[model samples]
Target: MRGCSRRAGRAARKRRQKCESSIQSVSLGHQLQYVRLRKFLHQRGFTSSLLQPALFTDTGRGLQTLKTIKPCQLIISLPESCLLTTATVLSSYLGQYIKSWKCRLSPLLALCVFLVCERHRGEASDWFPYIDALPTTYTCPAYFADGVLAVLPAGVRRRASEQRRAVRELHSSSRDFFGSLQPVLSQPVEEVFTYEALRWAWCSVNTRSVFMSHPSNNFLSGQDHYALAPFLDLLNHRPDVQVKASFNDATRCYEIRSVSGTVRYQQAFINYGSHDNQRLLLEYGFVAPGNPHSVVYVDADLLCDVLRGDRSLDQKRKFLKENNFVHNLTVSSDGPSWRLMTALRLLSMPQTLYRQWKAVLLGQAVCEEREEWSVHTAVTLCQRLLQDTNAALEKISDLLRQCDPAVREQLDVVQSLRQEERCILGRCLEALRGTVRQPDEALPCQPDDNDDDDAVS
Candidate 1:
C-alpha cells in the first residue's frame, strides 16, 4: 500500500481533551475543514487510526500520535484518486487547455494554475477542504511588511528583495499566459487568474507541496517530481527527521514512512532537508530554533571589496576569477567552508608567498606551507564580516528603539532573523579567532590544478 499520511480525524474511541488547540485560536472553519477532509479521506481509505493533526505550541498544527506507533508502520495510505500529481491537473477538463503549458511552462507552474482555477471553483472544486486548510498568511521574509524589510540586515534584506522580485516576475509571466486563455476561460476563472490570486495560489503550492513520483506506468517522473499530498502537509518540519515517501504501484497509492517513530501524544515531524532555520524561514515561512543547516552567508562581494584598490590586487582578482574561489562563501554550522577559510588564508598570505600559492589556488599543487600570518589573515577577514554584522544589528536596534508600534510587530520577525544570522556568524568568528595555529601545520590542500575537485569537493 502507498505509505500515505492522514492525521486529521480523531480515532474511533473518545479522545483526551489535551488534543484541544494549544492556542485555542484556530478558526472553527479550519477545524471543520479538517474534519470534513478527514472524513473524506477515511471513506476513501487514505487515513490512519493511530494519529490525528493537532495544534502544538511550538509547531502550529501537525500530526500527533493517539496510539503507540512502531517504526515502519503504515502511517496512512491514499489511493491514486487522492494523489495530486501533475497528471491529476493536466488531465482535468480545464487542464486539457494547457497542454502547451507542459512544454512552455514548468510543471510547477501548471500545478499552480490548476490550484488557482480549481480553488476559485469553490465547493465545485475537488480539493476545497485542502485549500481551505492552508495558512492564509505566509511568514517568509520575502513576504515581510515594508517596515520589517527597512530594518533588516542588508544581506538578508537583499535576498528577500531579490526573491520577491523573482516571484513578481513569475506572477507576471503566469498572468500573461492566463490572458492568452481568456477567451476560453470563464469569467470567474479570468478573475482568479489575476496576479494577486495567482501569487497566493503559487505560494500555497510552493510552501506545502512535496515531491512524490507519479505511480502510473505511463508517468515517468521521479524523486524530484512533486505532488500536493493531503495528510502529509500537516506534518511539521524537523531538520533531522527524514521521510521514506514513495508511490507503490501494486497498491495504487502513495505511502510515507517517517525515519523516526512517534509515541502516543508526541508530534511527528518530517525533515525539510537539513536546512538551517534561515532557509526554513525563507522557503517554508517558519523558523526552527537551532537549525542544523544554519549559516552566515559570507558574500563574495565582501571578499572582493578587500582586494579592490590594493597593489597586485589585480593579479589576485584574476586568480580568484580563474579559480572561481570568489563565490558562494559561507560560515556554516561546521564553521567556514574549506573554500572560504582557505581563500581567506591565501588572500592573507604576503605577496611573494601568494605567488607560490598561485599554483595552489589554480589547483596545480596540493598543500601550501601554512604561514604564521595565515591564521591572522583568516581572523581579520572574519572580524571584518563580524564588524559589518554588528553594524547591521546596531541599525536594527536603533529602529527597534524608535518604538513605532505599527512596525514593531512586524520588525520582531526581522529582528529575530538578524539575531539568528548574527549568532551563526558570531559563533563562526569566535572559533576562527581562537584557533591555536600549528606552526607549519599543513595548509589544507585544494585538489591538483588540473583536477575538478576545486568545485567544492
Candidate 2:
C-alpha cells in the first residue's frame, strides 16, 4: 500500500509539472512580435535588455525582468529616433499637408492622424513593428459601447460621455485635414480616416504614450509633450513602484531608472503618478484593485438632497462653490474626506450659528450639538450612498447574466469599480456610526423651525 501511494504521488507531481509547462508555453506565445520589436529597437539604439515582454496572470501584458534588477539601475533607454512623436509626424509624407493647412493641428490629433496613416500602410511602414505591438482595441471609455457606458457609476458614466464627445468632435473637425491626405493615399480619404479608425488611433496614443517635452513648434497647436515609446510603454502601472523617467541629455536617450528593484522573472512596473482607480479606468482602461488612492465621490445633487431641509442651503451651496469645495467631496476607508465633513458641518449649522460658517471652514471647535448634527448628517449621506451602491451592484449582476461575452468583459470592469466604492462606503458608514452617541437615532438633519427668527442673522 505504501509503495502504491508513493507511485500515485509521483504521477500527480508529473501531471502538475506538465500543466505548468503548457501554461508557460501559452503565455509566451506573443514572443515573436516582441522579438521583432527588440530587433527593430536594437537597430535604432535600444540597449537595455533587463526587461522583456511577457503575459502576467495579474496584469495581462507587462514587462518582466530577464534578470534581477537592483534599485537605481537603468532599466530602459530608448533613443529619440525610436520614439514616435509629433516631430515624426511633421517629417512624414503628411508633413507638407499639415504644415500648409489653414489651421494648426493639435499635437494629439497629429499623432492620431500619423498612427492611422501608418497603420493603413501596414508592412510598408517604417514603424510597423512598434505600431503592431500596440493594442488593437483599447478598453478606454472612448471604446466602451453605449450599453456598457450605461452601467457605469454616475461619475464614471458622465466622464465617459465627455470622452466620447471629445473624440467625436476631433474626428468631425479633422475631415478637411484628412482630405488633404488623399494625394499620398491609395484609398479615399474618408475610407482611410473613418471615425472608427481615428478612434482606435486616438485610444492608442492616449493610453500608451509616454511624456516627452519637445521644443515649441509653430505647426502644432498645443504643447508637444507626447511621445509613443515602443517597448518602454509595456511597463504596467503599480501604485507602489517608483521610477525616475526622463530624457537623458548626456545619453541622448529616453531613460527609465528603477527606484524600486524588481525580482528576476517577475513583472516590472512603473508608477503612473498616484492615480485613483476612477482616473485609471477612465484614462487607461484598467483599474488597480485595492488602489490606496481610490475614493467614493459624493455627487453634488445627492449631497444637496441629503441636506434638503437646511434653511441656508443656497448660501451653503454658494459658499462651497466659491471655496472650490463643491467638487471632490469623497469617502474613503479612513472616513469622510475633510472637504465633505467641512461641507456637512457648515450645512448642519442652525440659523443661530449662521455667522460661524467661516469658523467652521477654519476647523474651529463646534458646539457638541452642532458636532452631533454634522455627524448625523454624514451618517445619513453614507447610508444613502451604501443603498445606491448596493442597488447598482445588483443591477450589474442582472445585466451580467444577460450580457454577451464581449459586453460581459466591459461590465466586469464596471462591477469592480462599483464594488470598490461599496467597500469604501461601508467603511465610512461604520466609522460614522461608531462616533455617534445615539447611533440608532442618527437621523438626517432637519430644518430648525424654532430658529426661523434668526435665519437672517
Tens digit of lDDT per residue, candidate 1, span 300-413?
667667545345555665677678877666776446777766666555444555545665564443333343344445555567866866776677677778866645644655
Candidate 1 TM-score, C-alpha based: 0.77
RMSD of each: 8.3, 7.6
- Hey, what RMSD does candidate 1 come out at? 8.3
In candidate 2, position 134 carries an lDDT of: 87
TM-score of each model, in listed order: 0.77, 0.90
Give all candidates' CA lDDT scores. 0.63, 0.80
lDDT of 2 at 374: 78
Q: For candidate 1, which ten residues in a row score worst on lDDT?
A: 448-457
Where in model 1 is the C-alpha error above 4 Å? 1-30, 100-103, 150-158, 180-190, 214-224, 307-309, 350-355, 362-372, 390-413, 436-457
What lDDT score goes with residue 253 in model 2? 87
Q: TM-score of predicted model 2?
A: 0.90
lDDT score for residue 305 of model 1: 70
